[model samples]
Target: MTTPPFPAPTTAELAVVSAQLGRTARGVVGIAARCECGNPTVVATTPRLPDGTPFPTFYYLTHPAATAAMSTLEATQVMPELSALLAEDDGVAAAYLAAHEAYLADRAQFGEVSEIDGISAGGMPSRVKCLHALAGHALAAGPGVNPIGDAALERSTWSPEKCRCDDPGAALRDVEASTA
Candidate 1:
């Protein structure tokens, strides 16, 4: 199995992630990225789940705010816009290919599975499918790793530099409302 770049998940981290996702955290191998308040923002999951299911998404966005921001962008028809860029910009296509390679390398750490081989999320190297997945990879890999993800993040209302979770009470209320 591949080792996650981030630290192993603490029980408390998993709890926070479950709260963030409004579901039990499954196959989470590491906390890929954290909010300014030190809560999980992105989680690195196993390539293959415990049930032997091949899950291609290695980096998953966990923070409600980040997910919401990506959703909003998606609703604005950002996917096609970005997909057009991918079609027209050779540099972007190359970078996206590199991102896809990076994703494959990262997942290879978990062990190579035929079912998910050469498949990277967010329609890498060709199209933009899921901004959340792209953003998750950006957050996990850091800036400059995934260009589309970086672009989406740059256009987002949220920023890692900002401490949006400074107020736990507010964050909890928002999370509760989202889960509800």
Candidate 2:
């Protein structure tokens, strides 16, 4: 079956979310990048385990430009319309709410894994993997689809065997300082 595309956030919305993410990542082991498409890219490296294994992961936030580009629709038109749809229909609002919940749950799971065991920067489970999984999930869920399933969710999950960093914090600091 052909997979549907995901809904993207507007530039303004992306900026708002990116700023929040920056604040959260500040002083932590991650760096945020603003794409030309107005999307936010978050890179998280992993620390090596006692056994010398690694686990790295990356994340992406839908920017207004990318979102618009993906849907071939104007952000100005889509954002307001989505808002109006949620306001007008309870079912639509519920779907949106469900999607939000699923997104948050997946993010939290990623964060928990990254923090507990750390992630690697030079190997598999890279930021691209995380972002791809997130985007794929969102697209599969689609707009106005309630109670999204968790199938294929674990495909994005990171493991130490896939990483190759000795110190994620140091890598994160290096990236953050260089970007700043």
Candidate 3:
């Protein structure tokens, strides 16, 4: 079994996360990142869930605002542009590979799941697949650890330095209205 990176999550933290996700947040072990208002922005989930499922996503973005921002970027086709950058810039490609390795290392600290081995979320070490996952890693690991994640965050409307935790659903509502 993988040991959690930190202590178990508090009830309040889990509640906030559930509210942000609009569902019961499962397999969450610790608060990886928090909003300025102390709400969970990114959660560190277990590699293996309670149901004997092999899960891959270690850092999960739980903040509604961050999720919405990443979704907006994906909707606007930012992934292709990031993929092109990976293809064109050897430095970024190398950094991305390092980021992938770092992600694997972080997960290893908890435990390893063979089914999800070598698989870091957001298509790490290659193309960008999910900005939410990447942004989660960026928030959890901090800036400069995940270059693509940092880039995505740079292009996002959300800012971690700011606190929008007061109304978790507000950002999602805004995203819905904008998309509508």
Cα RMSD (angstroms) for every candidate in the order listed: 4.5, 16.2, 6.7
Estimate candidate 3's alpha-carbon lDDT, on a 0 to 1 scale. Answer: 0.85
Cα miss at 6, model 1 (Å)?
A: 1.3
Tens digits of per-residue lDDT, candidate 1, 1-180, equal 645677788776777788788989889989898887767899988889889999999999988889989999999988888888889999989999999999889978877789988998988867899999999999999899899999999989998767666574455445555566
Best by TM-score: 1
What stretches of model 2 exceed 4 Å from their correct place? Answer: 1-72, 112-137, 140-180
Clashing pairs in 1: 2-109, 2-110
State how far residue 94 of model 2 sits from its true place (Å). 0.8
- Listed in order, each prediction's TM-score against the native is 0.89, 0.31, 0.88
For residue 54, model 2's alpha carbon misses the true position, in angstroms, by 21
Better of 2 and 3 by TM-score: 3
Number of clashes recorded per candidate: 2, 11, 0
State, as a TM-score between 0 and 1, how close model 2 is to the true structure: 0.31
Specify the poorest-scoring 10-residue window by lDDT in model 1: 168-177
lDDT by residue (tens digit), candidate 3, 17-69: 78788998889889998777666789998899889898899999988888999
